[model samples]
Target: MTTNGECRTNGTRRPKPLLSRSCSENYEINDVDVPGTPKTPRTSTTPGHEKCTFHHDLELDHNPPTREAMLPEMSRSYRLLLESLGENPDRPGLLKTPERAAKAMLFFTKGYDQSLEEVLNDAIFDEDHDEMVVVKDIEMFSMCEHHLVPFYGKVSIGYLPCGKILGLSKLARIVEIYSRRLQVQERLTKQIAVAVTKAVQPAGVAVVVEGVHMCMVMRGVQKINSKTVTSTMLGVFRDDPKTREEFLNLVHSK
Candidate 1:
């Protein structure tokens, strides 16, 4: 019962869809001579097509990568690093080592995703008690900026609050914000002092950082028992010797 460019489907006959070049075009099936394949003479319909044609471009740009996307590149770099060190990355024992190390390295430097303002989160309080409040023996861990090795120990902070005091827990949180990044001890000490000064505008601020840098202890001189101490003194702690001494003495006291 069907006739003249009509097709029957389940006993129904409809006019056939008109096939234009666009509709009939096959995006795949490009008759190009691929680099590794045998070169066939070009057909007129596929003229000037010498390069391989892929269904989609594999280039990446524009968007920021998610943690999952970044992991593969980090793992690849670690594998390349192993190869550079003349170690076989594809060995049975080392097969997943790159992935494990990538995850570990990302965790170690996770502070890059944090901000000082975000960490503070309105932890400042209106207080008129103007005394030297000291927080000492705060555990700190940081990667040395130069060698990307660990430098960990204790941080001691003291500040004379003018009108505002930070919530005690924020002190440790602040230390953690800066300590988790790649840093130099001197810069880290000064950054913590400056952050406290900015947050509370204290009468004075003092910070002392004592660390055993693996960059120094594990390599490059390798002094196994050596320790590095860096300090920052601002405002009264910088100008008044007695205030500085008092802060120092408190930090040093057991």
Candidate 2:
């Protein structure tokens, strides 16, 4: 007979778990709550946790999601959201709006439906070349967690290979996996860097994102020209200024 609960639930304490998240969603953007816009709440699958190799405060699910199973319920929520905005969802022109909006929302936040391993697809290959690899001007689009609006721009990623390298296109796919979710620019940048690090266990990783947010442009302050830039540097990138400068110089070049 089993005497401990650890064996049944925790199992063998797996290595570099691709699946991880917090027990509660405790972080928030201060002084940004609009008069009517409510914050998005995330559900915790674990008892409580950031449970990853990098231990980021993010939920990276490894299992594929059942999008069809969620459509009906999400569509209903959109119908209610429409009503809250003082609109008649039952009107002929709007009858199908809720369903369409739900589908779009799911597509926008599709990152939650993905896992690092699934997208990597065994693309990592052994290489003797120990040099910096960079992919720049990668198109990125993501939803703002606070207002559920979009922020889009380009991402530039650079990594120092450590006897291994990932496929070139996979760098962009990493951006997509994280950008297609509810995020803030800061967290999104770090998440992209962290994913690249996990993919190849690179000696260092760097990610920079410059974005124009709909939340800032379409509402609250409404500055049409405002843009945000965020970056995450790890390992040699964080330690070596010369190496970091080289990456930045390359990414900024036309």
Candidate 3:
């Protein structure tokens, strides 16, 4: 019988212990001398700039939270909710309902995972122009903390710059960040005005919100067409009646 390191009558050496028959029988194998095509170049590993093969920034970006990581816990909680509602969670029609509901709920309340710092970063700018900057009709949607129902509407913001100004879109984003959370309309208006004041320290900040609460429309008083108006004024806006009046007129105008 042929043994290790032995040659056969056909002029082929016995296969090495680590190699398969596909390896050339006549060539000596060296562990250190691997032979094949060259390796492809590795991707750059710069921080916050890595190349993602799938789901770009879906896993890496954690400012608002990732849906996949929250899915499991949220789905289990939703199933319990179904039981509380006396609904069969295992039925064919409801089997996947928990997952869908979890995803939807997470999306609706994602503001809980975000912070003002992350949203405002790189969005504020210093400028010398000191005029009243107004962003009107900024749409917002929020859940009423009292009833967990939706309240949605538009906001009007006006600010007199002291030495800084926010990006126009950033103002809208600020509204979205706070509006996505469980909130009351009055507090939501004040929070938007406060956020702008804090970010830019403008001479004055004013915010007005007109919302229709689902709790009012869907239940309780069931006032389907009723609207709630709330406002917050700071600095010169609160001190100067003329400034406040102008802001109100601009917001109420078509």
Candidate 4:
């Protein structure tokens, strides 16, 4: 006798037994012997026979928030700090100050997010010109690392090319990168010089900064007109008096 779900093999009907249990719920099924077809036997349960199913196609979704999404919240906290400092955040003049300040700060401190390599990408060119190249009077605004007060300044850079010269704008960019962070003027000047020297492997590098620190003028000494000058001289600039004098004279000339 053939079962309803059984099929014939070699044009002969095969004997198969019908069971009340289904494959989904059954612990086991009996093998049915049939003519011209071999029977498939089921093994008895061993110690660790556990039912398992194979599945295909698994996926994951991941998303991260952007800087723009988080900046507004940070600006709000800064605005609250301003309000706590006894300033009215709702005043007509101050209404947009917080947002503006946040944006300006983002611009000022953008150097932190930029790499020196990326900033000077392809900006360096091979040049046999060994003369001093000076770019002067680049404006800089930074916060004092000590007091977080504003310090505005001018920077002048000069370098003697060994076999490479950087783009004029890149020198200013180097200054901006160091200046945008909270820094001591001395360290900022040295960092700029060191970066330029390393980037171009120049024969010499000199950096000079003249700054008016708000902390000094607004609170400490209160000397409004006093400006601090700091500089770094490397390689030939340190050993050669004529080279150093040329750099200094050009920087202070105007």
Candidate 5:
């Protein structure tokens, strides 16, 4: 990590840590460390310039209510944002908009407040079953870190259990914990796989995310039909072609 809080790898700057300290310490979920430039914090509160501060600004902890308490302050920034748009924020129609938007923004990024342990809640159970377990078509919604627009998707997770299995719903809960934050689909997919691996020490884990990013449709290339797919395969899933093919077949099937 650099002094400015970004990551350094192979003499190149990288993006911020993919996982928070609480979650990362337990799960070690981060896998990719691609090159990127360090972003300098800007005081500008204009649209697209403002973002959720979470730990960087507040040294956020596990308690989400603490983050929730910052809503009034967040709303102040939102009020400035409305002013930056040259709109009448005080008008009755927009009078409550700042705080309302603040609530929504904070809720949208609440994944910053979650840790894998909270999601699991001691849900892992010992089982002699060693067959592949698959959960598919888990709906997910997330913010694009780059453009801050929405990317909605479905995630399919699979793991070959060793001595333990997680509660079925906990898989979707894992998806929720990661997808609720500002993210790239690539990291989100890997994080889910890693979290599962850590929870169960599975023989292998596989995750696939199929996302339609609003950023592509609403801006940039304006490619309305574009969808992004990213996947992460660990352990046997990465090493065994047949096993990987089986997981992919399961994920892609209806």
Candidate 6:
């Protein structure tokens, strides 16, 4: 209108007037300072402030936990479990049972932390003698996977080497690798034979395990005197009956 526009200086353009609007009305305005559309403010608390809920709730304490702080909590839980099984946790004989059980369990399952390569490190020797090297009656103790109860007995390993022969103790170490894990006798026997075969590249490898499964003896039929026998044969042992027979005979011998 001329009434408003005429009031401006002759050389200058008149400024636009703002329209009257209610508080409920929303206006479309571009914010050039912002790269894109304007955004509503986030309601979250800032970090590091005492009043910041996220700072208080999400931040972890920097201190490392002490062994003393851990042991009692663990022992209490185990003691509760023993008590739940109808055993007296505070009995004189059972007072240290939790600690003893924890230590024993760690030792029993230590194979999980051990490696076959480390156990057999540099134990292979280059030998010209190609013979059936047998290590027999290796004592083995393992937990049954199904029951988590101990089943233990003996293992016998025999391998005919091509050029490399494992140390006698390495045979026992291989037995220990499978034995330390929760396993079935059949699988353990096969694993030992296979590992020995691969490690030494032997002409043949044979493993026999004789053990009493606690699942069978302690729970199922409860036949205390019964034992389970399993065997695995590889390479020539698998092909030649005579080679297998010799291995069996040697294992059965003293």
TM-score of 2: 0.76
lDDT of 3 by residue, 162-198 (tens): 5467899889988987787778888788778767766
**Higher-lDDT candidate among 2 and 5?**
5
- Name the runs in model 1 displaced over 4 angstroms: 1-64
Off by over 4 Å in 2: 1-65
Instruction: Give a tens-digit lDDT track for model 6, residues 1-254.
Output: 24442213334432211111111221211211111111432234324433432211111232223334445656777888899999998899999998877666656755554556777888989776556788898999999889889999999898876657889988888777667766778778766775775577666678889998888887989999999999877666766789899999999986
lDDT of each: 0.71, 0.72, 0.70, 0.68, 0.75, 0.66
Candidate 4: count the clashes: 0
TM-score winner among the candidates? 5
lDDT minimum window of 10 residues, candidate 2:
14-23
TM-score of model 4 (CA atoms): 0.68
The candidate with the higher TM-score, 1 or 3, is 1
Candidate 4 lDDT over residue span 1-254, tens digit each: 23563324445542221122232231122221111111332222323322311101011021223335556876898789888999988889888887887777767666555556767888989764667899999999998889878899899999877556899889888787778876888878777876786577665678889999999999988999999999877766776789899999998895
TM-score of 3: 0.72
**Candidate 5 TM-score, C-alpha based:** 0.77
The best-first sequence of candidates by lDDT reads 5, 2, 1, 3, 4, 6
**TM-scores of the candidates in the order shown:** 0.73, 0.76, 0.72, 0.68, 0.77, 0.69
What is the lDDT for 18 in model 4? 17
